[model samples]
Target chain A: MRDKFNEQLEQLNVELIKMGALCEEAISAAAKALLEGDAALRETAAAAEREIDQKERDIESLCMKLLLQQQPVARDLRTISAALKMISDMERIGDQASDIAEITRDIEDSPVVSHVPIAEMARSTIGMVTDSIDSFVRKNLGLAQEVIRKDDEIDRMFLDVKDELIRRIGQGDSGETCMDLLMIAKYFERIGDHACNIAEWVEYSLTGQHGDM
Target chain B: MRDKFNEQLEQLNVELIKMGALCEEAISAAAKALLEGDAALRETAAAAEREIDQKERDIESLCMKLLLQQQPVARDLRTISAALKMISDMERIGDQASDIAEITRDIEDSPVVSHVPIAEMARSTIGMVTDSIDSFVRKNLGLAQEVIRKDDEIDRMFLDVKDELIRRIGQGDSGETCMDLLMIAKYFERIGDHACNIAEWVEYSLTGQHGDM
Candidate 1:
């Protein structure tokens, strides 16, 4: 029975890793679509979002079954519960990525603004998300902490993006274009937040206490 | 033992309602702060946010204890698990409210813009949140659906807010002010999303399937 449980647990970890990879793909596609004015990648990101949603349901059922069939105690219970919470964040990351794609689709034909630091912000956020998931899969507390620390940088980047948009608007740029850029930057910041949340859950699962505790 | 479980469940419901009310207060306070240029009310919202965070931690511990000690199955398990998910949404609602408050604090001394329709959006979102929690407590699937439907109106209002901000920016209004208003409207839209999520979980608890299912 213990061996079977461990096997199932390992399967859960594998599924989570797959879901994380999907999120990474979705966000990276969305970012590239936004930066390159590529409308086709928006569709790609949307498809990935749908897949991520399906993955969430699959992982949720697995966690519920593990909880019910195994009635896991202590660390096992925490791991499953944390997986449950982590997937919600992962699913939202996917949703936010889709949202970014939707916005990029709308602005795909518009004249591109070159001054916003959005591409760099997107890269940083993607790294944070990947590191957070890796921290979870490897149970690396230090990596999780690093993800948390990186959030401040994302926040700062968002402010920079906002300021840049404001400056462009004041310089007589189209308000609509500025608004779209601002929204995309804000989505990247939100994705960073979800990544931080996943890292915190990873920490909780490993140590049985969140960072605040 | 069954009676004790029922009693604990009732207590959990009460706490959830209390947390929901706090969310309503925080959002309302933040809205008033933004509309009235009331910096004091921003502080009030911040205080409520702190309380809401405390309540989340408390409720989480209670849920964990219930899960570990009672080992509930089937419907009972669903209800507890749904509550666990609902609190995360509720906590996010609180955070969004506080975020709105923070933006208002920065703009409180600025000349107020009166055309954003934020007040109506806040009222609609607060109603959705209240109804979602009520649906959970009463197991009212109809009310849950109502809350879900209400989300569309909030989304529409957010678009209206965005349009108004863009119009103002085009009319040579302060870019900073427009950006602040846009962020506040976005936060309200996000609160509506969280409320919809809570309502979906409530529906899941009652029907054993999420809205998507």
Candidate 2:
């Protein structure tokens, strides 16, 4: 019985990693679609978003089963609970990616996007997402802390993007296009936040210390 | 022992209601601050945000203790787990309130804000937050479903706000002010989403049915 419980714990880890991969795929596709104006990549991002949502449901059920059947305690309980929390953030990241894709579908690309550092922002946020999940899979406290710290940079980039967009608007650039780009930038910043949240859960699982607390 | 568990469950309910109250206060203060351009209300919102964050930590610890000591299963376990999930969304509502307040602090009252339906959006979102918590407190599945349905209207208001702001920008209104207004509107929409999430958790606790599923 103990061995089977351990096996189930391992299964939880595998499923979380898979869900993380789906989030990465979704965001990457959405960002690429934004930078390149590629319709195919937008569809890829949307498809991955759907897959991410399904993965959340599946992983949530697995965690619930483990919690109910095994009645895990202490560290085991923490791990499973942390998975429950992490999946919510991961699901939000998928939604943000989809929201970004939706915007791209609604409007054509404007030169205003090239004026801001949005592509760099996306790359940095994607890095945080990748590192955050890696920290969870490896149970690395240092990497988890690093991901948390990286969020400040994303926040700063968002402000910079906001200021630049405001400047473009002042210059009488296409107001709608600037609005869309700002929304896209905001979504990227939000995705960074979810990645930061995932890392915090990793910290909680490993050290029993919630970042906010 | 079962009697003690029942008392603790009641305690959990009380704490959730308290946290919900704090979230409502934060958002309402922020909205009032934006409309009146009142610095005092912004400070009030900030204080509520701090309290909301502390409340999250306190409630999280309480839930963990209940789960660990009681090892609850079935419906009891579901209720406790649902509370755990609900607090995260509640905490995010606090953050959105803070974000809205921050934007108001950065800019003066603009005439453009008066032109948009932002006040209506804020009112609708605050109502959703209140009802979402009320549903959880009462375990009213109908109220929870109502909150979920209301999210669609919030989404529609957001697009309306976007279009109106875009038109203002096109008319050579203050670009920076319009951008700030748009961000504030988006934050309101996000709070509505968080409220919707809390209601969904209420549904899950009551009926074992996740809204997304």
Per-candidate fnat, comma-separated = 0.47, 0.53
State, as a TM-score between 0 and 1, how close model 2 is to the true structure. 0.94
lDDT per residue for candidate 2 within A151-176, as digits (tens), equals 99999999899888888888888888
DockQ of 1: 0.60
TM-score of chain B of each: 0.97, 0.98
Error of 2 at B155 (Å): 1.7
Which number leads on DockQ? 1
Residue B108's lDDT within candidate 2 is 58
Task: Quote each prediction's TM-score.
Answer: 0.96, 0.94
Q: List chain A TM-scores, every candidate, in order.
A: 0.97, 0.97
lDDT of 2 at A32: 83
- Please give the DockQ score of every candidate, comma-separated: 0.60, 0.55
CAPRI class assigned to model 2: medium
lDDT of 1 by residue, B1-213 (tens): 888888999999999999999999999999999888888999989989988988988898788778767879888989998998899899889989999989986776555357778889999999999999999999999999999998999999999889888988998889988888888899999999999999999988998989865
